[model samples]
Target: MRNPQRLNVPIQLDRDLPEPLHDQLAAQLRRAIARGQLAGRMPSTRTLAGVLGISRGVALAAYEVLLAEGRITGRHGSGTYVSGTGSAPVGAGSLPVRASDVVVDLRSDRPSTQAFPLAAWRAAWRRASHQAPPVEEPPPAGLPALRAAVAAYLRESRGLVLDGHEVVVTAGYADALALILRARHGAGRALIALEDPAPPALRHALARLGTVLPLPTDASGARPDLVPAGCDVVAVLPERGVLGARMPTERRRALAAWARESGGLVLEPAFDGLFNPSLTPRPSVLALGDADSTAMVGSFCDLLTPTLRLSFAVVPRRPAGAVEEGLHGQPSVTCQLAVADLLASGCVARRAERLSVLYGAKRAFVRQVLGAYPDTRLLGGDTGAAAALLLPAAVRAESVVGALLARRVRVADLAAFCHESGVRENGIAFSYGHLDAGLLSGALHALTGTLDDHRLPRRSAA
Candidate 1:
């Protein structure tokens, strides 16, 4: 056993100082622990009292107070020691196991089904199913009526006027992007410039096709003024995922100008725009510049349902041929016709409006819950169902995410979306889609408890 004097905690008790002896000792001990002076095994109550010239009961009372607060623990015949104070530095390996019996998931990427227009969608599908079955092959571009409806809806909603001929229906965003790249791939080697922190799957797809150069984006989702001079295609997300920020108008014009000057193509994926209905909608890059320079890609998976697997790209007259050459097969005629009816009957527009209102409220509530904790900031909840939470500097996002998962609250770390290394924002994206109030509250509580567990000071570096 260590000597009583070597206990090292400075305890100066003044009986005439009005404050009780035990309270004063406990306060000082708390300070010592906070300052890393007191750790591991502490001197026994008898030894501490003898060293400080205090009664044994007074020393015991002080130790009992610290024990009650979980600052110290006593093991039978082993003496008391500092407890509930983490001594190991936070890291990926030290994180909790990601399995639990509790059930609450906050992983970002889940879609909100609360506001789905089931009645309208069923009615549209019924109408499409009732139509006389045609034995003709699906058109190379898409069903004529569907293309026309998409064009009309785009004009009315996003202010992007395009002929039905410009619309090419595809399976989804991936299919649409692949078609664009194939059409834009001219004689020489194909090089593409993409924004950093983009969709991981899309980046992987681009890497498989050709060389991809990453362009950094600013706080508002605008790319830097300069890009590689020789790239044939420049793909941008108007509503960037993870970050949940949008590109500025001036930046949009710059991108269009680059595409026009370099004789390249700008593929703008307006996935978020599908559900986000604004009074003054932001015109797509296709509308901002000449049709030859830009193509707009959209997906129905954002609004209706992901399983529907319907998407389209609006291209210029010249590249319309490229889409035809690249596309292997057409989308399902029945699904296309159903969506067409939705667009033509204004059901899509009305549904988008209702979704905007419904999700807007849910997003606000989620932000409120996440914002209640100190040292946390929310990044993207503008147009998507997910929001990125910036954590405290000392906190590692993966560790917290893992901790939450161990308690059955699943969330994804933002670093998972990056293409390169050394990115250290320490954020996790939480998706509040389709989560009811009770589930959300429970998840938040679990997250809170996990964070609380990490509040103790970790072991210092060697």
Candidate 2:
């Protein structure tokens, strides 16, 4: 921790500004501490109120915002201290996970449903139920409050800066992709480029468009330069993933630039809270480049649960027209408002940060257990609910999966994720999201034991 010291800087606040005074003060403080203008210890709320000639409530509120973001911490007896340096970029995006049940689900996409905020969700649902009835059908663009809330969630939690006008609510991820495809014009089968080895749902969505050529990727995520020439649309998860790799900030910029230069659209997940909040946030692709050609599409499946079908996309200049023209069917108003309440109040961000930390611990366990096995290579990138291990060339993935299933432990084959040939290599996926600590450890042991027996057939030998 930095040495505790007093804040020494001039804080300017304009009362006439449309933004709230507390918000203004919070913004200035956030920037100041991040840029080393005034950091370490800060004055008490009462002291700040007097010093700045503002109400005590305003000062307290400003501190609360920073505290929520983990940018500042208030010592019980001591003053507030800077907790962050603001050197990392804020990121937004999500990778959709596929789910099923087993004694131990090793599938790469399952979320920890146990951690689902049932209490908070119940409260939000009740609040939504009490809202005033809508006289007319909600707008296709989604409830205004929900849109604003989504924007705020992105800004606070994901680090992407956007507003309500940029967001369009949809049923979910596939719907967002379909809407984008329809939003396009003069399309004789919308030629599209998809990140290789993506979720089957994504592939299915693109199937409704035109031919989807696989955009090549390595352990570092998809390559923007390899996007097919003349493709009308490109979709990718800008956030990093386990074995799924991540598109770096530079790659994101290039991809965003590619969209602009090629006049194509870039579709990405709007909110993926799978990343560890303890680390520096990665910037969304849209955040790094002109959003006029890029769209960030996401849903609450990972954030809340898979049952809540609501989703949103930060629409670009072109697609914004189609979205407003009824490209989407608005979700139920009550649910929308309830979600709006959560996002607007920072509940979603707080919950996501907690879950990320929990999952990060589980991920580390998997690494520590299986990382040392022969021919087992843990995939790169520390964000995602799932973990991937590259198996020895001799171990057959299908056999391993079958063996695990027979033993009541289910896992996913990397081949299952590959749509076109050559999208991924031989590997197996393990998910700890839905699994408890004890189950996960047992599953790891079973996995290592399975790998120990050379009785399993090798590819060439098979």
Candidate 3:
């Protein structure tokens, strides 16, 4: 069999220019490689020179430049090949490269989608698609049916006695936060109070628009005393921490009272605990006598898939108009209808019940595994998708996280969540929602081994 001629790359150079011929040639080849035209094996320097009507020395020099820069590889007997730097050729049937060799994933932000009711959801979607709305544009507050369904769901499950009018639909958590900020402050720097170990995404969202005054937290959650005066908004999770710490009842009241006194608004997330059976429903800030000064955010991400991007905010009557205006576009009509069907037909509740059982068992398994290490303290499991594993003071949380990542198992470092530099809590947050029982077991085994390896040396030295 005869090999085809290797001459796909189209190179043009000017001999009249001040630039060296080799330099111009190399530059052309560089462009070709970047455009993916120069993938796979390249013609030999002698052959390339002959084809391009250039001197063999110039071609060789250009090839040397590419070689030194690690752009191409030269085999002793075989011709030069495009190095791994270039993308695979189009229609070459190259398999998609895996991002990592991750055998188990325990990343905290992810929710469980393994047991999603795909059949029922598809049925709902089909039904929604068939029933087209008379109007193409959805109402800014969402479809009337979805808004009513959301209000009813919250009222029944969370004990909020709110009407459907209070429910404002949003694209997601980020969109909800953006709307809240815009409606309240309207393009000014607002100092917001945030829990020390708040969700990184929330902190990141507020970073540009506001100055975050860190509220230090203990076992019972964010300390009310530490909430600085003059901040306009204080963000917290309803009766819980971002990673599942149960806030004491007194503390919750105290925080609400602080908001009342300071004339600051409270933004409580009721996002993650919908399916947590262990947690008894407490009075939300809206119900606990701070309804006027609080805005509660929740999402279907915990109930369904994150990519669905459906969320709602219980906005007070005062800023209701502005918040509605800020929500410029409506959520997808089909999604709103499907969710409405799920909520109305009680499909969501049934799924939540099953998830409640699964997550409870998974949480217990995690606690049991972490219990083997006496120095490690389990902080929160009352609600939410993840639990915090507080480590001894000396163990660097980032180092252990790095070790686990090296073994292709990922977990969140508790330190990364803290907004304040002075706070030095060390730990990992394990999200068990996404992983199945078998993978969760394997992840725990690897996590325990990594923790042990890091701990033994410090113990011996001390």
Candidate 4:
């Protein structure tokens, strides 16, 4: 009667229960086996009794009950085997039902999925599918033609000087970052220093494999000095610093220096960098002749629709081969094909240009609405895509959020971006990218009314 070596149950039995220990153990084991935990194996009655500190007679009695119930079958020489009843049935649904459906979804980060260029995408996909040779092989680090097109697009539109060979297509910015991190530093020893108030998705991804050091950020952006000296990598949002403004050139140079000095890697996420119509495009850290120390990453999803999951990373010249090898080792071919189709079709580039103009107008409209409410203080002044509004200190952001939700107006609280525990100032971050003029106007009106009802003071005109 040896104990079942294969069985791994998570429950801890309570000896003080009024129910007999053997009955309790039997009931728990039955449920565990029924739930597929004790599949294909049976523990010996003697071993079970020894482990549970129960009498051998009690263990034999429990085994008799289980045997009668057809939970296990004893082979002649070998120990008992778990019967068919011991394992749970497969293919069961276990999803929860929602009580009330959400009407407005403002929490998403990308443009509406319905607005995706489906017709153009389908035509391009069909064209690619047909032209693609049967028994397809993975594209040379993503379709060569697409790479060339991206190179040309970046050079002309983004002020980046890149060759097709330098660009490697990725599923999205998140995937690109993961691949680059994996390549430069093996899955182990990859420590990424992230901004304290960073995108939750990116933070979660980095946290899964690497040590994450949360560096504090302010209006200027992530302070490079705060980054731990020994960190192997650093992730920075160049376009939208901590408070959502462009990181100054001086700070960029300092970060470059940090990477160079420490033999560290820098992942520069150029989010919404192309949308800035006012400022000259800042050179990417990877493109700053420090390709050995930095990787430039960007995504088309924000400019186009989220369905177009095309992103690219320009690795340092020396590490390009290692990065490509690491990428191929990982499973990401489907995403590469989809991105290639989108890029080759020229739909994403065209849509991005159109969206630039549309979002520009929307940004202007939001500004006008902010202007109407003289008390509101606009943070991240002249930022192209998203704007932050600071409400009076007296107004409760949670109350304002609830009121806006009641009016079917969706917006995000600035406090959600805070990393530390304390009473944060009242503010809201508004993205004009997906909003239309009417919706933007309505939301502004609701926000103004909410502020007025709370009797919050307005910022005085400078």
Best by TM-score: 3
lDDT of 4 by residue, 1-462 (tens): 233454567534567854445555666666565445665556677877677666887777666556655777877877776675223322245221121222233444555222345557656666656544546655535666666777777776657775422777776666777677777776675877887566666777777758777777777877888887689988888777535657777878888888888999888764553455566777766565366788777677675545556777777554344555555432244445555566666777776665666656666676665665566677654655666777766666777788878766677887775544423547776565554343456566777777767775555666
Give lDDT: candidate 2, residue 421: 56
For model 1, how does the per-residue alpha-carbon lDDT over 1-462 read when each residue is reduced to its tens digit?
222564575666778854467766776676566445666678788888888888997888788767755778988877787774334432344432222444566754655554345557878889888877778758878899998998888778767767422888887777777776676674334697777677677788777667888766667674737577678888788655457777777788888888778788887775563355553456567777767778877887666666778888787776334556777677778888999999998887876776676667667777765666667777776665677778887889889988988777788787866657324457787777546444666777787687778782323344
Predicted structure 2: lDDT: 0.70
- Give lDDT: candidate 4, residue 445: 73
Better of 1 and 4 by lDDT: 1
Clashes of each: 1, 7, 0, 1
The residue ranges of model 2 lying beyond 4 angstroms of the native Cα positions read 1-102, 163-165, 186-188, 318-321, 324-328, 455-462
Model 4 per-residue lDDT at 449? 77
Q: What is candidate 1's CA lDDT for residue 20?
A: 60
Alpha-carbon lDDT, every model: 0.70, 0.70, 0.73, 0.64
In candidate 1, which residue ranges exceed 4 Å CA deviation?
A: 1-103, 163-165, 186-189, 273-280, 319-322, 421-424, 456-462
Output the TM-score of candidate 2. 0.72
For residues 1-462, could you state the per-residue lDDT of candidate 3 as single tens digits?
122257465566688964467767776676566445666678788887777788898888788767765778987776687786333343456432342543456765566644456558878999999975656678777788998898888877777787422778888777777777766788787898888888788788877668887877777777778888788988876565755666767777887897788777888875555467665666776666465677777888777767777988777755344556667576789888999999998888887887777677777788777766777777666455577888777788898899998877888888778876648578887677766554677788788889878863323322
Model 3 earns a TM-score of 0.74
Which candidate has the highest lDDT of all?
3
What lDDT is obtained when candidate 1 is compared to the true structure?
0.70
**TM per model?**
0.72, 0.72, 0.74, 0.68
Candidates ranked by TM-score: 3, 2, 1, 4
TM-score winner between 1 and 4, please give it.
1
**Two-way lDDT contest, 2 vs 3, winner:** 3
